[model samples]
Structure formats: C-alpha cells, structure tokens
Target: MNRVDRLHSPFEQHSRALAWLAVFGLLLAATNLRGGLVVFAPLVLEIREALSLSASAFGMLTTLPLICFAVISILVPLMTRFFSSITLVVFGLLIISLGVVLRLVASYPVVILGTLLLGSAIALLNVLIPVLVKVFFPSRMGLMTGLYSIMLSLGAGMGLYLAVPMLEYFGHWHYPVMVWALLPLLTCLIWLPLLKLRGEVKPVTGARVTLWKSATAWAVTLYMGLQSFYFYAIVTWLPNILIESGLNPLEAGSTTAMISLASIPFNLFIPIFATKMHNQRSLVVLISLLSFSGLTGLWWAPQLAPMLWAALIGMGAGGALSLSLSFFILRTGDGVQATALSAMAQSLGYLLAATGPVTLALMHDISGHWLTALMLLMLLQIFQFAFGWKAAAAVQIKPDINTHSSKRTP
Candidate 1:
C-alpha cells in the first residue's frame, strides 16, 4: 500500500465535536477493558474459598478471559466483514455490560459463563483498537496510545485498590462485580455518535491481508505473547506469592497495587518516547533487565525491597504492554495492515497468555513452591529480549518476501 492507500480517511475531521467525542469514547472504552479482569486479583483467595475451588480450578477462572481472547480472535476478520470498528466497539460494550450482570448470579456455572462473555467482549476491543487508532488518530498514534494506555493502567491499578474496599462496603463480592456494568453503558452512549461520524464507509482493499512475508510481524507477535505470558501469570499469582512469603492479604494487595501504579508512567509515556527514537531495542533491554532483577529480588527477598521490586517489574512488564501496542502501529505500514497485524498478534498472544495462570499454578503444585514458577517467568524475559531485538528493528512489515502456506487468512 502506498501513502494514499495507507492514509485514506475513515472519517472526516472537520467536526471538532466528533473528534472530541471519539477521544472521550476511546479512553472510556479502554478503562473498561481490564477492570473486568483486575477485579479477580485482589479477591482470589476469598473467591477460591467461597467457591470451594482448587488452585487449578481458580487458575482456570483467571485464564478463561485469555482463552476467550484467543478463541474470538479468529473471528475478528470475519466480524469486520459486516460491522465498522466503531460499531463493533459499541457491541463489545453491550456484551461486557451483559456479562457483568451475569456474573452476579453467584453460581459457578453462571460465573464462568459471565467470564466467558466478558472475555469475548474485551477481545473485540483489544483486537479492534489498533485499527480504530489507525483510522481516527493516524497522525497522533503515539500520543493517543499513551492517553488510552494510561487509562488502561489506571483502571487496572484502581481496580486492584478498589476490590477489597468494595467488597467491604458491599458486604459481598457480587455487588462489586456488577458495579462495573455502568462503565460500558456510559461508554456506549459516548460511542454511538461515532457511527454517524464515520458515515458508514469502510476500507476494503487491504481487507484480510497480513504481513506474513516479513519476519518482523512474527517477532512482534512473539514479543507481545511473551510479555503477556509473564504479566498474566504474575497478576494472577503475585498476591498469593506475597502472602505465602508472610505478608497479610492487605499487604499482598498493596504490593499488587504498587506494581500496577508503577507501570502507569511507563504506559503513558513509552509510546511517545519510542516514536521519537531510532529503535526501542534499548528500552526493551533496559526493562527486561529491570524485570529480571525485580523477579529475582522477589524470589530471594520478598519482604525486603518489595516496593522497589514491584516498581521494576511494573516498568519492565507494564512498559512491555505499551510497547507491544505501539509496535503494532510502528512496525506496520498503514491502518489496514496494522489491523491485520494487531488481530494476528493479539489472537495468538492472548492464547499464549492463557497458559500463564495454569502453568504457574501447576508448577507450584508439583514443586510446592513458587521458585520453579518464578524461574519460568524469568526465563520468559530472556525470550522477550531476543524477539524484541528483531521487532524493534528499523523496518516496516510489508510483504517484501513470500512465505507460502496451505491455507490463507481471509
């Protein structure tokens, strides 16, 4: 795709009102994505005992959303065939609201069903945001990314902090879970105007196309997956890990909150910083070392330097999250291919992430300690470093070379 094809307008930019609405809606929608998932971290132990579930079973609950992301990703290309990304986001918000309500039923089956629904809902937004950014904020991808990503970080941080308080005030877990339903509902109202602004036009020339010819695409995908692998694994188990090391539930939750907070600055600034640089390989290397040291410190001295280790992990891992999203646009030529690459990366990445919780939980079960599990996380950082080297290369993922397969993506 040339400059004209890559930069084609998805919506007219003459209306200041519509532009503001899109920005507002985009940030609000981002805030909702991780709230549904983060709510489980602070309450995992209470939830485990309440449900009478085994470690393995609880792991499944945490992993269900990622599993949903993986499964639903294959359908994204198909879903876009009928609906614009703006319209798709509205539908996602509705499904998330419905799923939040379903979670209040308190039955095991009902809760699992709700999780599946919400996970699938988040999957749509996760895969669609890059495409929408390409359409609406092409010239300001980094700044816009930082804005939405900070919201993601804040939502996640605040979610962990609010979980216990909400539980205390509501006197039950179900009510707190249902409160998030309002976010998406309000977001829907804000997003509805976007469809009118888009004028129902769609881009089809680059539809269903992928960057299979370039090795950078695979590198970006692997980096995305490996970072997610460590992140989800840590979030699901870190509180418990701290508790096992002698902290109370409050302290454990505090550490989790601190970790989330630490990542916020990085999430808000990494994209903008990256866009101004030659390559992000050095940033990746710096964060990897920080994460490696943090994980080591946690394993060796959980009580000592808890805040420092958490911050390091946050900058390393949380920073990785922003970088991964930035790479989607940075490494791709245009919005159309960015969508294709984002869909491919997130689909497989989250699927790869679905294993994090279970794998760590199982490792603990077999070894009777978190050492084996922590070591596994440490090893993943090395892999992330290797892949980030190529992904952060100064090249775009165009179809420069051919790599054939029996099947095609459409």
Candidate 2:
C-alpha cells in the first residue's frame, strides 16, 4: 500500500476502538497539563517559608513556568519535525515527574532547576495536545476540544482543593508537591499504548506556513492572550478585591470557589456548542459581554451580588479559553498548520499572559486601589471582543488544503 493508504487502513478498519482509546488517553493527559502548575499555587506560602525565599524570589519561582511556556512553545513546531506528538507528550510527562522529584530535595538551586524542568516539559504538552486532537479526532474537533478543556479546569480545581490536604497528610510541603508527580506518571502510563499506533500517525511535512504574517493568526493570538490575561489577573486578585470590598476572608474564599465552580459547566459545553455553529463570533461577543458586565459589577458594586457577578466572569473566562483553543484547530487546515498556530498563539499569548497578574498588582500599587486595575481590565474586554470576532470567522489557515475529512457542522 502507499503511505496514504497505509495511514488510512488501520483507522478505517478499527476506528471505533482506536477512537475510544485516543479519547481516554487524551483526557487523562489533559488532567496532568494544568494540575502541576496550579498545584504549586496553593502551596506557595508554605513553600516560601520552607525554602527561605524572599517575596521576589517566590514570585519568580511562580512566574518561571509561564515564562517557560512562552519560550518553549515557539520551539515545539521545530521538535515536531523530529518526533511525533505522542512521543513528545510521553517524554514531557516523564520529565515533569523528574522535575517534581527534584523539587523535593529542599535546596534552592535544586528547586529552581526543578521548576525550570517542569515548566519546559509542560510547555511541550501545551503546544502539541491540540495537534493530537486535530490529528486523531478531526471530525469531532469541538467535542474533543471541549472535553479536554473541561479536564484542564477539573485538574486545576482538584489540585487547588487537594494541595493543603496533601501537605497536612504528609506533614511536609515537599511531599505534597511530590505527590502531584503521580498524576503525570500515571498519565504517562495511560499514553503508552498509543505509541504503537504512531505508524498510522506521523508528523505532517509540508511547506511552512508563516503564522506570524497572517492577520487571522494574529487575531487568534491576541484573542488567546487577552482572554488568558483576564483569567490569570482575576484569579490572582479576585480574593483581594472581595476582601477590599468588606467581605471577610472566609467570604472571599467562598466567593472564589463560586467563581471556579461556575466555570466548570460552561467549560464543559461552550466549545462543543461553538463548533456546531456557522461561526463563533456570537459566542465571542457573548463571552466578552459576560466578562465585561461581571467586571463592571465588581468595580461599581461588588457587594451587591458577588456570587452572580463571579459566576458570570467564570463562565466568560472558561468559555473564552475553550473557544480560543478551538481556534487553533478551527482556523487551521491540518494538524501541521494547527501545531504551528498553536505554538505561535501559546508562545506569544502566554508571554502576554505572564504579564497579567504582575501588571494588575502594579496598577493596584500605583493607584492605591483596585478601581483603576478593574477599569483597565474592563477596557481589555473591548479589545478581546474585537480580535475574537475576527478570529471567529469561518476560514482556514491554508485554504488549498483538502478539508473533506474534517467538515464543519452545517
């Protein structure tokens, strides 16, 4: 058989069983994606005290992964030329496990090294998972995107909720962090079976598409960046905003939970719904309005209906994230193009995202209140709507690539 026929033969014969395996492995991998980074978040104070880190040092430790994401993502497309997406994912997970173990050594230099390794490993997974989705489940892009997107949020939530408990159970901050290594390790095992299927799926070799020069690619990148920025800033500051608005620590904590919880269902559904439509512009506008209205409520009268406002922001942020990810697949012609766009969007997008929390903090410091910061965020939603609208157009990165195998919902 020819190479194309060889690629199609196994899939055409055993599509159902292979698809189930692919979906399971993809979801399991998704669970490990964000959990490692967020697991560090809830353990921050404990880690800082244990490691004797200064506030700035601790901030850098937390920020390092985001910087890695921005830097490492740009290199993923290059790596694809040498390895299949599955191989990179498997290697990345093991590296993450090693990084987790290294951090438990309790030495400052060791911890920095470990954090760097963790960030670099995750950066690989971040850029390539969508490429896998496009390769294996092109026909169900929205459904698979939505499912993995929900898993990402689920993983983060589980990490946040479980981190302190793990610390208490192990009686050391190191052990709590170390225990998270189990996730990637386990996920690594789940993906092992897929390696044998690699013969059916090789990296796409084509004339390089210059994502940087495409206005549509830029639109997708900006949409991805602004939505990510809003998410990180709100997550970092919402509690403080609540406390400043006269709520007790307990109340603020509960409100934050409400925000996290509210996003789950929307994350579960929005991408699936978006893909079935003719275009996602309406969804983008809807998400921006929800975030804008929520931010307005928080700025003007947060005490009035905190839960309502929080939920709206959560839904908006969650939906925007899933939609932006969908753009990586929706806007591309094939898995190769998707990988390039995903790398470009995440590299620049996360570099922009890396600035989010710090910028908000700086604004609050300069203005002596969060009103200015909140207003700035509200203004950003306007730009998010504009870029997201352009990105939401029904088109492809390579118009000449045949799309018969991956038709959109009519």
Best by TM-score: 2
Over 4 Å off, model 2: 1-10, 13-15, 205-207, 399-410
TM-score of candidate 2 versus the correct structure, residues matched by position: 0.93
Query: For model 2, how does the per-residue alpha-carbon lDDT over 289-378 read when each residue is reduced to its tens digit?
Result: 899999999999989999998999999999999999999988887677788889999998899989999999999999999999999999
Tell me the whole-model lDDT of each prediction, alpha carbons only: 0.79, 0.83
What TM-score against the true fold does each predicted structure earn? 0.89, 0.93
Model 1 TM-score (2 dp): 0.89
> Pairs clashing in candidate 2?
none
